[model samples]
Target chain A: MKSARPDSQGHFGPYGGIFVPETLMEPLRELTRVYKVAQKDPAFKKELDYYLREYVGRPSPLWFAQRMTAQLGGPKIYLKREDLNHTGAHKINNVVGQALLARRLGKTRLIAETGAGQHGVATATAAALFGMECTVYMGKVDMERQALNVFRMESLGAKVVAVTAGQQTLKEAINEAMRDWVSNLRNTHYVLGTAFGPHPYPMIVRDFQSVIGKEARKQILKAEGRLPAAVIACVGGGSNAIGIFSAFIKDEGVRLIGVEAGGLGIVPGKHAARFAGGKVGVLQGTKSYVLQDDDGQILLTHSVSAGLDYASVGPEHAMLHDTGRAEYTYIEDADAVAGFDQLAQWEGILPALESSHAIAWVVKNAGQFAKNDIVIINVSGRGDKDVQQIAEWKKGQSTK
Target chain B: MKKTRVDQKFAALKKQGKKGFIAYIGAGDPSLDDTVDIVLRLEEAGVDLVELGLPFSDPLADGRVNQDAAARALEAGATFDGVMNCVAKIRERSQIPLIFYAYLNTLYARGFEKAMNEAAAAGIDGFLILDMPREESGPYRKFISAASLNSIVLITPTTPEERMKQIVKDASGFVYCVSREGVTGVRDSIAEGARGLVGKIKGHTRLPVALGFGIGTPPQAAEAASFADAVVVGSAIVNKFHNNPHTPEGRADAAAFVAEMVKAVKAVNSPL
Candidate 1:
C-alpha cells in the first residue's frame, strides 16, 4: 500500500506549505517527517485509537431526524454526532492528536487562540491530560461572551490571557498567539484551533482531524447501506467541514456543501461570509480569501456565533472552492436562528450556533432533493452554551 | 530653498547637545481630528520627531496595544487619503519633523510614487515601512530619495553584519535599531544586545541611530542615550490615549505623559 504521507512540502494538492516564520521552520520540518512516521507506527495509532474509544467517546452516533425529514418532505436527514465528542466539539479530535505529537516532539508548553472558546477548552483539556503547561490567548470580546469557558480553562490550569487588540476578537487573538510563539518558539507548540494559519498547521490539523470523515464514511455506509447524497458542515476556519469533506473529496458521487455564517445579511461589510464577499488576500499567516478593506486590512467580521465570525476561510477551502470540488453557501442570522429553534423542538438536538449554519442551509434547501436522497449534516457542536443568546433573540423577535 | 523643518529640528537638537525624542502615534486613532490634536500636542511637548503610524490591521511587528490602536484608527474611517490629509492639516499649523511609519502593504497600495509625492507635499520628512528591509529597499528607496524624503531602516539585534552594512548604506536621516526581536512596546529596560547593535551601526555610518522598542522610563532612556543619538518611545506615549479622560483633562494627562518622558530623556544629557 502507498504511504499516506502528504507531499514533501506538506501540500494537499497545492493547498498546504510552510508559511511560518523562520524560527518555526526546523520544528515544522521535524514535525512533518515525524507525523509521517507516527502515522504508520502501530504504537502511535494504537494510543490514538485508545483515546478515541475510551477518552473521547468515539463512534459517535448517527441519528436519523424523522421530524426534519417529514418537514422537508424530501430527503431524509441524518447527523453525525461529533457534538458528543469530548470537550463538546470536533475540535478535540485534532487537539488530542496534536498534543500527542507535541509530546513526541519534546515540546513542553502549548499555546492556542480560541474564538468561541471551543478550541481553547479542547486544547486546555488535552494539555492538562498530557501534563503540559497551557496558555490560551482569547480576544477580550470573546472572553466576555464566553466567560464560563474562561473559568473552565483557568480551572484546567491554563492561563487565559484576554487580548484587547485589533478587533478584540479571534483574528487578533491569533496574532497575539503567533507573537507569543515567535518569542517563545524554543519550548512551545502552537495548537492552532482550526484548519487555517500557515502551511503545516492546516495540513497537520486536517490530517489529525480526518478521522471524522474516516469514521463517518464507515458509519454512514453501515447505517444507510450506501453513501449519502450530500455532506454538509459549517465553515468557520473550515476544520469540521474539511474533516468531513476530505474522505468524500475523492468520492465523485458525494456532494460537499460548506455553509458560511451570513450574519445579518450578505451585505458587503455586515457578515463573515467570505465565500460570498471576500477577495484573495493574506491574513493570520496564510494567503486565502479574506474579508478585508481595499488596503488589505482584515475587516471586523460579525456573526451570531463567535466561532463563525472569522474574516477568512481556510486556504484548503479556498483551493477547493477554486477547483470546484466543493460548493459553498451562506446562512443568515435569521435563518440560523430558525434552524436552531427547529433542531431543538423537532430533533431534541441543540446544534452549535456555528453548526446551525449547516443545519440552516440544509433546511432551506431540503425541498430540492428527492425523497430517496439522503443528507448527512455534521452536527459539529452542541448549543447548550448559546441558550441565553437564543432566548434573548427570541424575546426580541416576539417584541418585533 | 526653503529650509525643511526636519533639518531645522535636527540642527537645533545637534546645537543643544540633547538627543532627540521621537514618539510614534497611529494616525486617525480614535478619530482623525483627535490624532491631529495629539500630534500637535506631542510637538508642543518637545518631541523632536513625530512618527505617524499608518494603521494596518495585520501589523506583524506591533504588539497588541499598537495593533488595537491601529484597528481603532481604521474603524474611525482613517484611510490613506484621510491620513495624508491629516498630515497636511498638521503641516499648515506646525513645522515639526514628521515621518510616516507604516507597513509595506499600505505604501504599496497607495503606489510608492504617489505616496512619496503626497507625503513630500504634506511636509512629511521620512518613510519607515516596518516590514521592508534593506534587501527589498531598492525600488522604495529610489522613489523616496528621488522625491527628497528620507528612507529610515530598522536594525534589530539579530541583524547580521552584511545586512547591517546594506541598511546603513541605503539609509538616510537615521537608522532605527529595534531594541528587541518583537514589536513595539514599553519594557522594563533596554536589552543587553541594544548597546552592541548601536555600536555596530555606528561603525558603518555617521547618520543618527535612534534606539526604539521597549524604551519606557527616563532611566531606560538615559541608558539608551548613552549609546545612540536619539531614543524612540511609542507605546508609553500611546498608552496615554488608553487612559485619557477624553476631556480637556485627557489632553492634559496626555501632555503630562509626554512631559515626563521628555524629562527622562533630557535628564540623561542636558542641553549645555
Candidate 2:
C-alpha cells in the first residue's frame, strides 16, 4: 500500500493536520486508506459520474451576464450555475461522494454540522436515498433562522439537533458534530460539510467536489472556445471555491479569486475574513488562518450570510494564499447586499448569500478588467433562503 | 504533599481491585454556590476525581444535556474567572483530584500560559481542553507542564495506532478513552469495540486509561472497570441537574443524583 504520508499527516503548509484525540486515530487512518483506494477505482468514478449526470443535473450552464458586463464595461462575466443542481446548491456533489464512501466502509449512520442548512439538507437527502440513519447538528440560532431547512431535513428523515453553545453558529455546530462522532464511532460516519477539518478530510472533500471544476473546464472551453482569464468563488470553508479552482489549478493563465465575507467591516471581531484579518492558529480539527483574539481564543464572527460566518478558512485555501496560487480578498456586508440587489434586478437571479460574496467582489472590480477578458463566477447556490433576511435588512435600512 | 495525594489515590484504587469513577459536572450549573455544594457531595460519595466543566457559550463536544448545563451556568453568570473562583472554593473542602474540562478558546482567551498558572494555583489537578488533541499539544503541553498541571488527553476508538502511541507519550495523569463516536449520553450498554480499544491502548503505555461517554450505572462502571483503570460518567450525572430544570431545588436534586451515582460506583469498587 502506498504510504499515507505527507497529505494524511495534516501538514498543508502549516494549515492542516490531525488535531483530534487518540481515540479517533484508527478510524481516521482507516478512512484515509479506504478513500485513497476508492479514488482510483474506475467503478467508483463511474458511479459518481452517473449520479452527477442523472441525479444532480451536472454540466450546469455557463451563461454570460451580458447586461451586467456591458454596464461595467470591463469584461464579459460568465457564471457556472451550480445553483441548478438538484438540491439547489453545489453542496450535494460532495455529500453524495462521501456518503457512498461511508457505505463502502460499513458505516450505517450519517452525521453532519450545518451553517446555512445547504449541507445539512444535502446530507439528509443522501442519507435518505442510501438508507442510512442521519443526524444533523445546527446552532440554536441557526435552527431559528433557517427554520425552513429544519423542516426540509426532518422531512427527509433526519434528526436535527440544536447546538446552543458557543457563537450559536456554524463553528459551534461543527464542534458539536465532532463530539458526536467521537461518541458514535462504531456505526457512524461524519459527513463533513466542507473542505476543512482534520487531515484527509480537507484533501478528500476537495477531491470529491472537484467535479465542479472538471465539468466547468470542459463547458467553459466549449462555450467560449477558450479558457477564461479568471475564476471566482466565494470562500466559507472554501469547498465550492476549491472545487471550481482545482481543475484550473494547472492552467497557467487562469487566475483564481476567493472572496471571503467581510461582515460590517474588517475591524477586529466584526468579520469572517480569515485571510484579511486572521492569523495562524488551530481550530475545529485543522490549523489554518483563524480569526482569534490576542490570547488565541477564536472570536465571535459576524456576517449577514449565516453560511459564510466561519472563523477559519479551509486549510487548502490557507495553503493557496500562502503559496500565492490564489488571491484572497474580502467583500463587506453592504457590498454583498448591493450585489444581491443587482443580481436580482439585472440577471433575474437570486444568489445564495454565501455566493454573493463572490459577486460583490466581481462587481467591485469589474471596471478593472479589459472588455475582451472573460471571467467565470461560480454561482454556488440559489438565494431563496436569504430572501427573508435580505428583505428584513432592507426594511431596517429603509426605516433608518 | 502533591506527590502524597497522587500516591494515596493511586494506592486506594489499587487496593480496591477496581478502577476509580470520575464524574463531570458543569460548575455553577443552577448557581455558583450550589455547584460548590455539588462538587463536595460528589467527592464525599466516593468519586475518585471530579471534572468541573467551565461553562462557555460554545461547548462543541457536548450533547444537548451538557449543552443546556453550560447555558444555564453561563446564564447564572459563570465566567472563566468565576469558574476559577469556584474551583478555588472546591479546593477549600476537597483533596479529591479535580480536572477542569473546557474548550481551548476559553483557556486561549485568558492566555494559555496564564490560564494554566491560574488553574494550577486555583487547586486544579488537571486540564482537559475538549477541542484540542495531541497533534496541537505543543504550546499547550509545554505551558501546562511548566505549571505542573496534568493535561489529560482523550483517546477515542477511532484514533490511529501511530497517533495513539504519540498521544500516550504526551498524556499526563491519565488517558480519557471515549467509548463511542457520538457525544456524551447515557447508553444502555458499553460499545462492543471499547474492550478491544482498551487492550490496544494498554499495549501502548502504563498511563491509567479511563472509559467514558456512556457509563451511567454501577454495573456499567464495573463492566468497564474490568478492563480499564477508570470509568467516567458525565452526561448521566448532568441529566440529574436537568430533572429539576434550572431551579434551586433542581440544583439540590442534581447534587443528590451525583451522590446516588457515587454510591453505585462505590458498591462495585468496595471490598466485600
Interface RMSD of each: 4.6, 3.3
lDDT of candidate 2 over B146-262, digit per residue (tens): 888777888776677777888788877888888987677788999898999998998998777888988887678778877777789998888776576656566567667666655
Model 1, A186-298: lDDT tens digits are 67888998999766778888887788888888888888899888999999999999998888887778899999989988886689999899877546556578897777677
Per-candidate DockQ vs. reference: 0.16, 0.41
Looking at candidate 1, what is the lDDT of residue B104?
62
Candidate 2 interface RMS: 3.3
Give the DockQ-based CAPRI class for model 1: incorrect
For candidate 1, list the clashing residue pairs, or say none.
A17-A199
Full-model lDDT for every candidate: 0.82, 0.83
